[model samples]
Target: MELRQYLHAHGKDSIGIIGVSWAEDRFGDPSESRLQRIAAFIDPKIPVVRETDDLVKAFSPLEQVPANFVYNRSGKLIYGDGSPKLMTKKQLEGLLAGSK
Candidate 1:
């Protein structure tokens, strides 16, 4: 929530939010339903990108749920962490500020 608030206040034009899911049905619920449940917690306007098995493998090394990646204006991956919870508001703010 802090990330959302910080982005809304300072990075509105600079940051782009995208949610990626591998669409695994291991939980018995459909990926769409899982995404819907997730959407209930966040702003619905945020676009969710569904990645295929190959795409998921290509984009991230962890191959785990809830990976976060931050890219700068020039499309360079400046920050990546396995857990979004590990990143603090100030750290995100600093990353954005330093990227510029």
Candidate 2:
């Protein structure tokens, strides 16, 4: 299962997934329609937000595009990587196992 599905099925209301798109430096706000389109490709209904000053402060600095950060329920950063493999089911299981 994907991250969202995995979380929904086994997370037991403990996990929430959100996507942050980092393109403000090059393209700026993608607008509501584009945000919706991005959300369309995302399974399990995850909220996708554009980068902003508040988001930067909340999510930490973005080193590159597709920065992935995993935060605990207390809002503390746990796992972070820039690799797309972060979506792999096995890797996600490993990432979330100890988190629970």
Candidate 3:
């Protein structure tokens, strides 16, 4: 099963997922209207957070996009990799099992 489906079926209450996007202001800062339009385009099912600046630097001095992180119940990062791939269902299940 895919990560999204597995989360919904098994870990919906125990896990949370959020997607983040950086504000790439190369040419110029996009107007509020443009930003709103972009936000509207995102899927409502996925919770997304937008960062105007590099907030990852505060956690770790690494400038990597498409980072994946999994935090335990205590809000401690248990898994972090600068890759777009998500944890497999088995891997997530193992973590959940260990927590209890």
Candidate 4:
């Protein structure tokens, strides 16, 4: 949720959140819950694409655009690990600030 706020604060209308399905086994549902929290915290009207369980198993979104790395208009990686990194609210804020 915080990440969405940070991105909005920086004038971005959309930002992506990526997670591996395996994360559920390691981190539990709180991770997905957190995304929901962030959506509620930021813009309830915004869209969130959650890829998990049958959603991911049936559709491989990551196979097209992995996670973590930020892509510029030209398709260049700007920040983040080339894959998603579990981040805290503060870390997400810092990253959003850097993107600005």
Candidate 5:
């Protein structure tokens, strides 16, 4: 499952991983059928958020693709980078634990 691979099998209780898709930027708004098709391949426990105005507050200054954002359990942005696979689950768990 992409969810398992993305989080290295961690991420539960106070942690989770979600995929954000910007396909609408070029392909146009997502239809129910289109979202359903994409969801078919993903684990039902994981969510893929389609781009929308609702995202402006959290991801307004969007820069580049394949980006990574790590937010703490409090919904605070803790780490961000222009690259993917920046931090391991163990590292994140330790960091977040100390933050509390």
Candidate 6:
């Protein structure tokens, strides 16, 4: 999903973006660059990260799976599921807006 819309829906809230290569093919590296651009353009304060123990971390080789996972500040698992549903930009926005 596009970062700006997601941030707008969250409205000052923070969210992580973890990419699972095997989970979804909708997001590719080239498109990720676009998403990054959107992030920079809109929600620069949200913070985007890759491979960190923070809010977000993109992983590859999903089948080589690890038991570990990252959680949100609320202690919710943000990754490590088998084939997560691909979140479209609008879907993400809706979810974030509705999240408590």
lDDT of each: 0.69, 0.64, 0.58, 0.52, 0.61, 0.47
Among all candidates shown, the one with the greatest TM-score:
1
Q: Please give the range of 10 consecutive residues that has the lowest summed lDDT in model 4.
A: 58-67
lDDT tens digits by residue: candidate 2, 1-100 = 3655665567535567777776645667556776677666655377776667897776555566556677766777777745443456566677667777
Which residue window of length 10 is worst by lDDT in model 6?
A: 17-26
Write the residue-wise lDDT of candidate 4 on 1-100 in tens digits. 4455566665555465443333344454447676666556656655666445786554333333224455554555566543445455576556555766
Q: What's the TM-score of every candidate structure?
A: 0.74, 0.63, 0.58, 0.39, 0.53, 0.36
In model 4, which runs have C-alpha deviations exceeding 4 angstroms? 1-5, 12-22, 29-34, 52-67, 82-100
Ranked by TM-score from best down, the candidates are 1, 2, 3, 5, 4, 6
Put down candidate 6 lDDT per residue, 19-96, tens digits, no spaces.
322322334444566656655676555454444333223333334322234454576655445343444567554544
Task: Name the lDDT of candidate 2.
Answer: 0.64
lDDT of 1: 0.69
Alpha carbon lDDT at 61, candidate 1:
65
Candidate 5 TM-score versus the reference: 0.53
Best by lDDT: 1
Error of 1 at 98 (Å): 0.1
- The lDDT-based order of candidates, best leading, equals 1, 2, 5, 3, 4, 6
